[model samples]
Target: MTIQVGDRLPEAKLQRIRDGVEVVDTPTLFEGKRVVLFAVPGAFTPTCSERHLPGFVEHFDEFRDKGVEVLCMSVNDPFVMKAWGESQHVPDGLMMLADGNGDFSRALGLEMDASGYGMGKRSKRFSLYAEDGVVKQLNVEAPGEFRVSSAEHILSQLP
Candidate 1:
């Protein structure tokens, strides 16, 4: 089922380039934190690289000032995610996560099929705010749309 407001995030493992591709768990990351986790179909893609990730990178301190952790996820390997973060000049506190097999995305029922573009399974363009592991807000964009889920939009919706 699609995760919704008030629903606890599912248990899943995600990879991050921390000292060499460390595996992180959902509970460990969100158990006692206010987190904003955003997903893109693929890392380094047009809108994702140009607008989406940059928005977060640019306003990262604003979110941290409010005591919220920011995470960026994509359906690519850890290496790609690491490279993208480096190329984008992402700040240290902003995490770049790799859902390599789309396992976490599938668990949340947010996985999208991108075979037409030869990308295989990917996560839809979306963002969610969670506190103590329970979703507080979710902003999922419609296919090929970017109306919501931007860093600015999510910042405006913070509790």
Candidate 2:
């Protein structure tokens, strides 16, 4: 079963590019915080690059102002995530996390098989709001759909 609302997020390794350096096993990055984490299939794909990620990047300040930290995750490597963030002009507060091996995505039961597209395994499109490591809400999009997990949807549901 997929991860559900109110479940504590499972601890897993995460790869991130910090200050031009590669780092790993950064699950504690969200510990003791209220966080909104969204996962996409890949870094430079059409819908994700054009719409999904931009929505989060655009609304990042509002989320932060509401005392929530926002993170964007994908199955791509940290270098791709960092380059994508830079090319997209992502702001400072929005963190781009890499689930390179899909360990974290699998832990959440959100891994997708994109082998048909030659992308191998990747993450499904989804979003979660967590408080101190426990999930408060989760929005999982249907395959190839993008409506439920957008930034606007999450913001509208926020208290």
Candidate 3:
């Protein structure tokens, strides 16, 4: 089943790049925080590189002031995620997490088959708001659509 508002977030290990190295499990990062977690299909894909990530980067301070820790996830490995985060100059408030084996994506029921694009299985574009590990809200886009999960949309839903 798809994750929904009010559900406790699934517990899954994620690889985060810390000090230029890949670190594992790291779920404690969100244990006592209000987090806005958004996922994209891949690291450097057109929409993700130009639009999706920049939206979060540009709104980093606003999210922080609103007590939301922003996290971006993708199916890429930790090295790719690290490179992409550095390339984008991601702000400290924003975390770039690697769902390398798609365990987290699959757990959220957000995995998509993109084999035709040669990308194999990947994540659908989506965003969620969590408070101390329980989901507060969720915004999921229809396939090929981008309107619902943008920063603006998420901001509008913030209390």
How well is each residue in 42-126 modelled by candidate 2, as lDDT tens digits?
A: 9999999999999998888899999999999999889999999998889997889999899899999999999999999999999
Off by over 4 Å in 2: 22-27
Model 3 per-residue lDDT tens digits across residues 10-29: 88888887866656553576
- When 1 and 2 are scored with TM-score, the better candidate is 1
Q: Which residue pairs show backbone clashes in model 2?
A: none
Candidate 3 clashing pairs, residues 3+ apart or interchain = none
TM-score of 3: 0.95
Look at candidate 1 and tell me the lDDT of residue 53.
96
- Model 1: residues >4 Å from true position, as ranges? none
- Ordered from best to worst lDDT, the candidate numbers read 1, 2, 3
66-149: candidate 1 lDDT, tens digit per residue: 999999999999999999999999999899999999999999999999999999999999999999999999999999998699
RMSD of 2: 1.2
TM-score of decoy 2:
0.95
lDDT of 2: 0.89
lDDT of 3 at 123: 95
